[model samples]
Target: MLRTYKFRIEPTKEQREKINETLMYCRWLYNALLEQRITAYKRCGVSLTFYSQKKELPTLKKVCEEYKSVHSQVLQNVVERLDKTYQAFFRRLKQGEK
Candidate 1:
């Protein structure tokens, strides 16, 4: 059988600072990837896939200090979440929602 559990705990001042910083990095990465995808499609008629964005992380970390503090898997998950959002958007388009 599979199970799940949830808990809430308070963070220390330093930990809270790190957590806030990580959240900001994640938000920035998501927005940047989304913009890349949009611009690629608009200018080149191509939509960027998750793997393409994921591959860019290493290079991004080298140039962007904000990404260096965040873990690799956390950044990968952000790319995946944005991909899911794009997929849902196209699905809605197919359904004639807008």
Candidate 2:
């Protein structure tokens, strides 16, 4: 059997807004990246790639900085972890691993 773990974070109103913006930005970027890849695939048959995704990362960093301004450490950490996780996922995909 497996166990589940959960955590909670407390943030001020300003921090909360920043965190929300961060989530929105992440979702937007992720969807945009996926759509770009998919469209490329449909056009070129697997020639799609995410290298340009890095170019858009500055937007995420800007949002992170905004959140950090509000001392939203928890949100910042979550964003960092998510960024790392995406990198690992992309790496695994590159390696042909699910």
Candidate 3:
């Protein structure tokens, strides 16, 4: 047996602004990471794994101050999501689902 619950509430104006900012940062990071992986593969014939990307977080934070504001767990989740997407895409390709 299992149960689930969901709740929604109106956020304050500042909270809304902060939420938007966080989303913007996450979107930027996702795109940047994707680009990095693509470029690495195209130039070096290598695939960047999640762990390798995750290890760069500290350096990224140092280079981009805005990223520091976003929680580490949230940043890691973004990487994890991208990795999962890549895995699923490859899996489908392997199955010859063109």
Candidate 4:
């Protein structure tokens, strides 16, 4: 059997601000990682993998203090999502889907 539950709650003003900040950081990281992958492939014909980019999180945190505010797992999840997107895109391309 499968089951699901849902609940909703209001966040305090400070909590809301913190959540928004984390989201902004995630968005920034996603865009930066995407650009890095595209540039690497264009310049050197190398495709960046999720594990490769995930390994850079610690160094990124060291260079950008803002990323430290976001949880490591959350950032890894962002990388994973992008990788999945790329995989699906290529799969569809191989299947001749427009």
On TM-score, the leading prediction is 4
TM-scores of the models, in the order given:
0.90, 0.47, 0.92, 0.93
lDDT of 3 by residue, 1-98 (tens): 89999999899999999999999999999999999999999999999999999999989989989988899999999999999989999999999986
Each prediction's Cα RMSD? 2.2, 7.9, 1.7, 1.7
| lDDT of each residue in 17-37, candidate 2, tens digit only | 877876775565456556766
Clashes of each: 0, 0, 0, 0
lDDT of 4 at 26: 92
Question: How do the candidates rank by TM-score, highest first?
Answer: 4, 3, 1, 2
Kindly report which residue pairs in candidate 4 clash with one another: none
Tens digits of per-residue lDDT, candidate 4, 6-58, equal 99989999999999999999999999999999999999999999999999999
Lowest lDDT block of 10, candidate 2: 67-76
Q: What is the C-alpha lDDT of each candidate?
A: 0.94, 0.59, 0.95, 0.95
